[model samples]
Target: MGLPAMAIVLLMALLQTGTAAAETRAFSKARDAITEPSHAQYEYIVVGGGTAGCAIAATLSEHYKVLLLERGGTPYGNPSIERLEGWADLLRDDPTESSERSPIQAFRSADGVHNRRARVLGGGSAINAGFYNRASDAEVRAAGWKPKSVQEAYEWVEERIASPASLGPWQKALKNGLVQAGVTPDNGLTYEHIQGTKLGHSIFDAQGRRHTAADLLFSANDELLTVLTFASAQRIIFNVSDENKQPRATGVEYTDSRNATHFAYLQDGFQNEVILSAGALGSPQLLLLSGIGSCEHLAEFNITCHVDLSAVGAEMVDNPINAIVLVSPNPLETSLISVAGITHEGVVIEGASGGNWTWQWPGMGQLNIFPPLERSVEMISLVQTNLQNLSSNTKEQIDQSGFILSKVYDPISSGTLRLKSRDVSQNPYVKFNYYTHPRDVETCIRGVKYLHKLLQTPAFQGFRYTTVTPIIALLYPELSSSEGERTDGAYIPDLKNRTETANWCRDTVTTIWHFHGGCVLGKVVDKRYRVFGVRSLRVVDGSTFTKSPGTNPQATVMMLGRYVGVRMLKDRKIAEETVNSRN
Candidate 1:
């Protein structure tokens, strides 16, 4: 029974272990409100205060004047975003207490899958599950970034936010099950990409404090950095008036918190640039709005197409997860999200959680799992079928909970991203055509079966119990119904008709939000993270990924910022030194 509470969030430490206090000061300053300077020129402008944005702007600010514009406010005062128990709260929208100005934006994919995106500073890292793992070597190679700097980037990000999590009872059971199932040689706690079971790191420290990417700014030269929260980048302002007109990016048009329009220009040289770290959704959407996407789409908004690149928003992919919930007979208190293992196929399996809102009848032998919505009256119909023998008096305790999540680390099938409208305010059309490829669907199924076999091993005999009903059946009871027409769109788990399983996976699928590859590397942007056909512009967020990495992408996204930022900082310094020598 993989009872899943679907939410993705993260926090980072400092650039070095000894600098934790300095990192705290950096995060605190980012949390503190700063006045927007009246002057509008900067050597570099980073759009989006997200995981990558904070890192990029902070890193570059050390050597040059930089401006970071985040559409949402700082994450400091909000408990819903900063606490561990509030992890799930980051995903759920609060209509009564929230407004359109709220930081977390709820969106629906083209396939009708619903999820959340963070509009706040620190972006998804501050609001995610806090699982902080570095990307697999495969991801680093494919991203086509400089290879040596990969470790440097990882070390840079790890120092700021990484901490090994102590395993709880549920996580201990998970490790035992995996080791028993031959899925592991038991790789202990690490931020490295290992083949077997390992105790992963988290952004939360021993005292439960959250240090996000925003904390990394502490390493930057604050005198050269100006962070403007609640400021949204609307479009890249191109210099069309230049002779030979190669579409040089000169500045950015933006809307402040008050919705007032403003334009911030770059310093005079070509070295000055506008970096879009607005994330997968925001980056591509901004490109399309700024007249850089497919000619046909931009034509709809009557915008002049400067660059007719068809792949600006192509190859958007997400980790479509399969969840199962199991109930434990005893209080299995150890910790939350402490243990994880990798299958031979690179699939990731993780243990239970306490932050979710699941209901149970306990000894009465009944458990209730909630999908984001009831979805259909039929989704939970079969959930109670396996619990008929227990008594009604056993109180549901958070300590006794057991559940797990299994996700495909290397997903092959990807979707496309397009504009809903030219407006920066509207969410884009994201179609994750998940499980569209045979290999992708096959991997997900193997992951489920692998974990299922692992959990049944003797290692879990005392701490966990075999679930009574198949989770897929419980999630989509319509599959079990003979009235096939009523459940026409549901997926069936039988191997004979894998297409049915694919359909079910698509219909019931939810993202762990490791969304990648929009404005992909080698497609929309070059290996250097600069946009093709557009000068002085680059993308430094998850949107630049060529493919999804096999673990939580938060660490990778932050590393990318550091990797790119370090290069840019070094290059600009050399360029400036050469100019001074010539003078």
Candidate 2:
């Protein structure tokens, strides 16, 4: 025998861990969970090695020494994170697992709604649905970004993390349903943001593995890039200033794997800076913790105010989705589908087919999308052969295979994030305040109606056995005025689309996880993404987004990171030596 089975398994685990923990692991330790002593300093200290954090650090590392601090482990050896079918694994909350080490952090909003976010190196990209798309012209221009620069950034990101997705059987059916429902001119397969239905790209590779924002690091000058996993950034460290000089941020205080504390400082010259890309919730949390948020709230926590910026953790937006799970008679292939419906008002009816439905949602049948069929005495009597061998679990799994996750893109409802306490490891309070706006309620209704129309089409009916998701039908009773049936030439009236059922919208509305706008572009920071009243400090994540980007934020968030990185490279204040890091 080539080694014992248990021995082989142990050896393989060690090798996998070794590969992921090579250099970065050395920066952290485990005894009492403390970071070991080190004299190493970087030109830039990027906090929260997440989606934008990775992109910014990687881009800047092309010429400068960069230290990327992440609180979670590397994504390398995680089977649940690497495999396409493991999407839900990244979003699942295991309360039994400690927040400090868990890949998914569970959170509840002030409104009392709960959600989960990625705590791993790749951030949301490591846990999201992996649907990729470029930001619209309106969205890019909102930040006063040059189209060419933004375009270049988008291309750079695509080259590293994006691949054309091949439509599986379910995806093909979704495409047919969308087109048959008059989604638009049919843009076909693309990553561009066009006002028509199309099959976009995914972060998943043709090999069926996930390619997250962390993968962008490979494109960086590795010699200058240092990724420290399990390195939780506690707060931004700043240098004080005299009367004539503005205060500048010089470094960051972080805790490593061993819970050992460490400080990473910016170099003395060349305008060395500290960037905070710690995600929508994370970045704002860091800012507030560093005494950069509302002064009144800071006082309540017995923390001294620094910036007193009221908008640091305010003005958030997310796309409220209306998920409809349709049950099909035939079993479908397990893959990410890319069919979508686009409108000029920035409303998108996009969804994914439920592939890998069983593993992704083990108890999803409990949703009662379809009531299980009770066995009849006649059917039991008719079954004359193979009754003992039939797997009832497999049959139940097959019955729940069909799914359609419909979404209403770019909602108008804005939310906020606040700190629960001064403790660094503690999660901040979140309030999505979803569907408070009249427009958002209408959009949700319209999305539900549009999905209903899609279901009515003959192409979808050819395979779809019945409608299992009844929320849409409940929100607007007119879709069911005719028993939710697709009648020939029966167009749902415009009045139905504008239903004013506010409470239903609130109860049914939820985020697709594309949160933006906390430390806004101009209000919170300059277009260059610096925090006001702070020097050498910047927030370069979705937290800087001022409004809806009119699409999935993953790609746009990366592009913004790249765009801001280029500007930092060209900063006039940073001395030439400090800025140029070709060495």
Candidate 3:
């Protein structure tokens, strides 16, 4: 006799549960989290298991034992972070989620623009739109890095994380539109940051699965590397010399999830070092907290000053972005940044289309992805009156909309980072005075004009839903003198009038999330990336960059970690050989 229907159903459910248990998920706790207290010694202690942190640790682990301390947990098995489709959702802040465990930490800048930083193992690379492009040869030489070594470093990172992106419908259209707008010499598909329209490399695979800097850890000698996630580095442990009175970083003091403190130390060798790869904001913040920043500032917070480096949190900069949102007539593919139009005047154009547009402010005319804070009243009011017209649109129409954005290649205007609170978990206050420099305003104007040219291209006409009101045209209408539509069907007022263009640039300025500086090359660190007044301490991250490399800095940042680690190994080998021969 056959089994009863209910019995068959129960058996099927049991079988399914068994199969689920047997299957392994990718990147699910690939690196185990450390919850217990650890007091250990290693040849190298790298703070911040971020992009550079992971790379350097892996490279160093080949010969020396390394400890990589990350304040946040692993990105493994996080659906929101591991999938490209979850880009915006990954950035959106949830009030219910605690900052102590959130993969992305959202913070409001003093400039009134809201931004976010990574709090995961892979750092920004885990949360960012996975566009990968190499730095120009000029940038490599300017940084005083050897060309061959830089190439090798980049290749090492690329082989593990980056691959050629297969352009989706939206990116394909963007490529055609860019070329039609005279961004000529289409480089087809490439990883190099050349001047032209090209499809850059992506850390996302063909299946849209993201690969972050944490994956670089696979290169590490598993036995020699110890990655401690949920381990917040409180401060650097330094030992001052009695003879010279100079401080040398000896180890790092951190707290586990349970708030129990632990100390991780370096080995006895003089050459063994403590490196800070703790990002642009993080490295400086750690220095200040560790009593290595400005003496006056430290005293204000009741902290003793050790190094008195005034430039520790100076020269903060962010590339200002201005975007135009368009309602598309046809359904568009959801994609992260995959195409770039590089111009001669130091402006870059990139775009993305189709995602959950449910995150929006009423009458704000801006996606919540680039939401302005309450203090941004001027910016809010600038477009508030104009966006009221779209209040009646259905939610579905807004979902079909896409954006084309532009940014200045290298902005000159900058600000400083200061401590908001002494707490290690608190975000340091930073302001990037966007468009403050006259040249930056002009560069933005040039970039915006190119965006206009791109919209007028025939290739984009099919995708545009002109009848549904353009948010950009409504927000920043051309001045009366040039208010009329041209033959290309775009309002030329904002594009033709310098004053109007400048206003648009200022009013709508948002971050491309490419902020750099705070701990600059010559000011805070020497050519070797060592903190000037300290011994056996080095900072090797975006914090040391004079200017951001290429269209994005992720590739270069990862390469830098490997590059420096290899150099350190070579130098140590030479020193050891010399000592042996003399003996």
Candidate 4:
């Protein structure tokens, strides 16, 4: 069976299940109740109604009163959100025109691909391509964490969501074609499996639904949890102790749809906790505005520093993914697959010195047939030296390198996130510093060459494939001649305009929108997900990821949110029980 047949079969199966899932009633009463502001004060305040925020709020409301603050208005049965196929179309439109819009606009990559980030009530999850990958055992072990730490929480989440490989005939054909190519399988289970192989189509729930965190959080019976849509937090109110003490976050001050400014504080007689789920961009900005960023930067803005942790906005990492889109001669489409489906065996030959080495590299060593140690050390030394040299300001040289490498490969550029201003309204300064590392350019170059090899395989030989990148054409017109050409088991001609190709690489290479490492774990925050130097405040979003997870981070974010929420709830129960014993 191929991809199209698999899709039809999957679609039919989903339609049946969807009928039952769709029949489940939404919270009509609560939806109506919160439309007006007369509702009672909530016990917990969850800022940013995004992936993690939604999950945290939903779980917390199960046992305690909760309030969810969303800057965007309610989706209110948006058809675009409920339907899976509708997402392909929705990605092409402006998010601002819809009920919600991401603060950062989706930018076109150098190769003319769009990179989108969601700023809606459900955050990126609502607008994302509904693909699911789980973290592999190696990934878990590499992070030096136990599965028990988050296993039960992940199991509970998986029960509600499913990833099934129900491919139709056409889909299966495509998968088989990929297999026929040198692409090999990866032996791990995780969302966004980036191990050398590509496998499995992303799975939707039985009801053909992409399970956003909002779906998990909102329940019909939870009247105590009040969801306030179209409400954005302007600032968090902190209680100053004496003249020289650290200010504590008590509550948040916000503005509602009516333009009315209102303050939500801890209840008169109860201890309240404020969790910032405002995402990597929003959370760091909120902290800076509330005076919790670097003391030097905050002082420049004439704000007193509450905490002077320099790591609050450092060591950012994101996967720089480049896509190779080909037009299949047959009407075939692509879907997510397991890593085992695509990783090539013996690709990393033993004793292969220089770049092919992987044995000593911790992240790459997990693969059984990786290169030997000496080669790995050589590659590491070369990469470090290249990075050190390129870190200096040499725009012309870097640009030249970016273009040359990008034409035939993928680049591994690194960047940083810095505070642009103290004002919460201002966006953070994101300097991608793309192509800053020489090794990144080398990696990208290697990746492109590898892609070319895959394209030459019998599976892709007859496809009406062309590089869709206009920049590639503009720079290397000779290469464009082969665009839309069928492979004839012969080497394609090199670009006639090498300088033009170099120029294109220098100018056109762009980012893959995997922003990470603002409030990194173990540095800015403790292992428990609580921000360092701040009492009773925690960050449970992408910012907590210590390093970029090397794939789409939606599943990891969801897992982290679930883990933190469950832990917090368990600890709270223990504390309450201890108090009861004393009483």
Best by TM-score: 3
TM-score list, all predictions: 0.84, 0.82, 0.88, 0.72
Ordered from best to worst TM-score, the candidate numbers read: 3, 1, 2, 4
Give the C-alpha miss distance for residue 351 in model 2, angstroms.
2.3
Give the TM-score comparing model 4 with the true structure, all chains together: 0.72
lDDT for 545 in candidate 4 is 66
Best by lDDT: 3
Cα lDDT tens digits for candidate 2, 464-580: 545432422322234445533333211123434344333334543445677677888777889788888888888899888766464577888888888889878876435565546
Flag the better candidate by TM-score, 1 or 4: 1
lDDT of 1 at 38: 35
Please give, for residues 1-583, the per-residue lDDT of candidate 1 as tens digits. 1233210000000000111221223244442222554348999999888899988888898778998888887777566555555554454343222354586886767654456688888899887768888877766776676778888888888888778776766677788888888877898888877789888898877755667887787777878988877777889989877657579888888877666777889989869999999999999999898999899988988988999899988999988776544445566553446677888885888865442432111110112223333333233323323333322332233224455666878788888988877778888898887778888777877775675576567877765533323333433353456522221112224544556545545544666678887788888888888899888999888887766564678888898898999999888889889999999
**CA lDDT of every candidate:** 0.69, 0.66, 0.77, 0.50
State the lDDT at 467 in candidate 1. Answer: 34
Worst 10 residues of 2 by lDDT: 14-23
Give the worst 10-residue stretch by lDDT in candidate 4: 348-357
Per-residue lDDT of model 3, residues 248-321, tens digit only: 89999988888888899988997999999999899999999999999999988888788889999999998888
Q: Report how far off residue 375 is in candidate 3 (Å).
A: 5.4
Tell me model 3's lDDT, rounded to 2 decimals. 0.77
Return model 4's CA RMSD, one decimal.
Answer: 13.4
Q: Model 4 scores what on Cα lDDT?
A: 0.50
